[model samples]
Every structure is written in C-alpha cells, then in structure tokens.
Target: MTQTVGSRALSSPRELTRVADRSSFIYLERCIVHRDANAITAEDAEGTTHIPAATIGTLLLGPGTRITHQAMSVLGECGAAVAWVGENAVRYYAGGRALTRSSALAEAQAVAWANQRTRLDVARAMYRLRFPDEDPSGLTRRGLLGREGDRVKDCYRKNSERTGVRWRKRQYVPGDFTAGDTVNQAITAAAQCMYGITHAVVAALGCSPALGFVHSGHELSFVLDVADLYKTEIGIPLAFDIAAESDEDPGPRTRRALRDRIHQLGLLDRCVTDIKSLLLPSGTQASEITVADSDIDRVSLQSDHDQLLPSGTNYGDEAGW
Candidate 1:
C-alpha cells in the first residue's frame, strides 16, 4: 500500500536512533528544509544536503531558515526535537517534544523537585558534578551561587591566560550580540549552543524543562542547569580558542568548533547519562536506560489499588451489550 506523508507509519521509540547515537544537533540557516520520504533535504545556495530524520537529536533552525510542515511532521514522528534559534544561537525561541512514552523520568523529576530537602540535594548533586573537588552539601543556594560565580571568574581568567585573549569582564547585553568583545561573543555563542543541545537531551529523556533545582522562573530553567555543568569545561575553553584565532565571524566559527568538540567527546551520551542519574533513584545506572524498556505506545490507566489497568477495555458490568 502506498502511503502519503500524513498516513505513513510513525517510527517507534526503539526503532528511532538513540539520543547518544544521534548527532547532538544540526544547525541550519539560510536554507529551506523539507522532507523527502524519511530524509530531510536542506536546500541552500550551495547545494541540497540529505539528512536522516531519525539520526538527529535536534534540528536547530537558525536565522533565515524555513521548514515545511512535512519536515516537522517527520521530525516529530522520529522524536527529534526542533528548536528555532537566532544567529550564533544567541536567542532561543521555541522547541519541540519529549521523546519517551513512559512518564518515569518526569515523575522522578517532580518527586525530587516538589520537596525542599530533595530539591536541595539534587542541586548539591549538580554542583558536585560540575565541581568535583568542591563540597556543596554544606552550602546554601546563595552560597552555591557565590561559589559558582567565583569558579567561573577563575575559569575566564585562566582561559584568557591560556588563550592570550585580553582579560575582561564577561559582558553580554541581551538582544545585542555585537555588544560584547570577540571572546565574549564566542562565549555567548558556545553557551547558547550548549543550551540547545541540553534542551534536546532533556526533552528526549521526557523530563520537565521548567522544574529546576538551582535555576528558576523560566521554562528552560532545568535545561540551563544541565548546560552549565559543561560550560566551564567545554564552552569556556572553546570560546577562548575561537577568540584567540580571529574576530571574523566568531559566531559561526564558535558553533562549528563547539559542534566538532561535542561530537568528539561524545557529550550527548554523557548528557543523557548525567540527566538520568540525577533524576533517577540513587544507585541506578543511567547508561542502562533505553526507550524500548519504556515501551513506546504503551498506555495504561491508574487504579485505586496502586496498580495500572490495561487501557481500551470497558469497565462496565454489562460489557457485552
């Protein structure tokens, strides 16, 4: 049977490429993106590039990019996230879906977030992950923030010394990308890319992006939290390197450099593992998790007995009628 785009069968969670295996993200600008069967075709002045829809963790649509409805439909079916971003990824507009059918991770995140003690514990855990030598258990949220600021300052200083880039304060004016110096511009670009990548991983894991432990009041607060974990280690150094080279097109160069580094380091896999470990119970191995174990298309009804009932069955006594 011949099926139209609308009538085509969707790929199950197991059938789609795992988050770890997929490219962290594909950043496209000045191109028209449309679906050709299961592949995405990006048409630009250079040429058309064919991309497998299922192998994408996120489709980052930058400035001047237009996408068709069919492309969006296929991306959604494959559980690939789509994010609309600004040039140099400085502005993040909107995003797409959660990749899991099970509510396990989302429920776990809520449970941890809903309580003050557990929430603090999670925040401390995050800090510990970011700064292994530092103990965050005794610190209040304010103290944690202070420690983080101190470390970031040190990181900036060290990177400046390492890269020979002029040491200056991190200057970023919202809505103005050109306000900062070359280094600052690169830093902003790297940070934004990290956010986009982490957002995709968070969504793919089916966790709530709003329920954050450290960062608060934003829809992508949790995403920001996760992305910061790698900022000092990955983003700062890369940004410094980019700034050290030349001032020409810092945004694009930073994105390209960051993308290569992320793929080389397999940051996507580590991101998945880290998020799962943080949200899941203690002693749980995040690496062992898989979408198939969660069972795509599996649905159940909650009952009073603390058990799940099979869905799609009539519960009435006169069922045969």
Candidate 2:
C-alpha cells in the first residue's frame, strides 16, 4: 500500500496543481534587464522573463537609469524599496510595506523622540569633550552652544559645491526625492548605503531593526538609531568630501571609500549598552555578557547554535552533548 502525504491524490495526474511561490528576492548590480524601448527589466542571470515584482525584495537602479510606472507599481505591491543611482542617489519608492499606517506612525514617533534625546545627549557629550575646563553649569546656561547640525550641513554643502553638486535644504521627511545633481546624488547614495549596512548589522545581531532609543519603531528601529548617530557626525561630512573629490561618477569605489571612512571614524566601535545581556557559564561561575564590539563575533557564533541547544545552554555544554 502507498502512503499519501496530504489529503489530495498522490498518483492522479489530473488532480495535480502548481502552487505559486511569492517569496521576495534581491536584484544585484548585474541582474538588471533593459528593453528595446529605453526601459529596463531586472531578473536573475538565468534569463527568466517577466520577473515577478513580488519576487523582488529590493531593487537598486544604477546611475542614469529609469523604470516604468508599471514596474514601479509591481515593486510597490510586492513591498520593495527602489533605490536609484544619480547625483543624489535616492530611494524613489519604499513599496507598500513602508506606507502602512502602523509602520508610518511608529517610524515617525521613533525618529522624533530619538532625534530629541540624541541631540541632547550628543550636545552634552560634545560640550564636555570640547570644554573640559569650563564650568558645566555655565555651558548648560549658554543654551545650545554646539552647532553640530550646522557644521554637518555646511561641510556637506561646501564639499558638494566643490564637486559642482547642489542640494536642496535638508528635508528630514522620510521617502524619496530626486538629486539635483551628481554631487547631491552621491551624498544620498552614501547615506542610504550606510543605512542598508547598519540594518544588516542589526539584523545579524538578532535585534529589532525598528526600535531605537534615538529612533523608535516596528520598522528599521535599530537602523534609524545607528543612522542617527552617524549621519550628522560622519555620513554628512564624508558625503561632502566624496562629492568634492571624485570627478567621474562615484560608483562602487565611492561606496567602498565611504564604508572605509565609517570604519576610520570608529562608528562601529561606539558602545550601545542598552540591550539586555545573558549570563554565561565560566567554569562554576556565571557572568553577564553584554553585546559590544569585542563580543559581537562570539555572540554571533553562539546565536547560530542557539537553535540546537536551549536558550540558557552555555558554550561548554556543546562538548558534552
């Protein structure tokens, strides 16, 4: 006797049905497809036609490119972010998921609250570092002494202008906008690149991407937090310099340089100790291990093994079991 896996017939050819898979995937630089009518279609390298927009998780359109409304709609329906390359490489669209009401509210609240707190904290820290000999009360009474935002904007503007790029006023509003020139495009590209990288880092650490002390929410919380910390301090300045220096269009090379600058600025080295830590066994003793740069690699390894072992299982337990 033959056994059946489900309620349906196993041997009947006429009863067979094809199930559609709507999972999303990403399109890399080389996976883009172009049309004879000055349009482009993107898919995997296997030459599959009519790449379902739903299958696309994210679409990165390189510099000097365009997409049709139909394609954009498909991507939107499928919940994908369309990142374009240009002077201010911008996110043209953030798909359906980005526009959800709950997500929007959460994101807005997170950003606003985080921004306020971050501004205060950053100001205090900068004040202490800049004027150690000065009285703290005097600095507090001075009322908004540091001009970090202005410094960032001015540095960015100068660098952009040097590269023949001009940007409109900094619009903190979320979503996509066109870059006025190559310089503006470069700055936007660098910023988004940092955002993506930071999001990935937060995901790898098993932390909610949306839900930040400086950035709050159910979507991109941690990414927003990390971006808040770096954008004004590092990203803005780097974008300015990159815009000013590179004569030709800055592509992958520019991205690499930007990432290198982030590292040079020690962005990742900064400690975020707000997250709770788990106690780990060390011989007969247990110690609390917080997530930090030094412990990131070790924690990542342990996280991988967490599925096979219980939540509280220690590193040494693996050897016995």
Candidate with top lDDT is 1
Query: How would you encode candidate 1's per-residue C-alpha lDDT over 86-201 as one tens digit per residue?
Result: 76545555566667666778888999999999999999999999999998878998999999999999999999999899977989988889999999999999998888888888
Candidate 2 per-residue lDDT, tens place, 1-321, comes to 342212322211111100012211233454545322212255545662444443333355665444657666644433444555434343332423331211222323334345555434434543444334443343341353344344556666765566555666654433443423445555566677766545433432334455554334447655655654456556665665665676466445456677566556544334122111110112312112222213112212224554433344457655554
Total backbone collisions, model 2: 16
For candidate 1, report its TM-score. Answer: 0.90
266 Cα displacement, candidate 1 (Å): 0.5
lDDT, model 1: 0.85
Query: TM per model?
Result: 0.90, 0.42
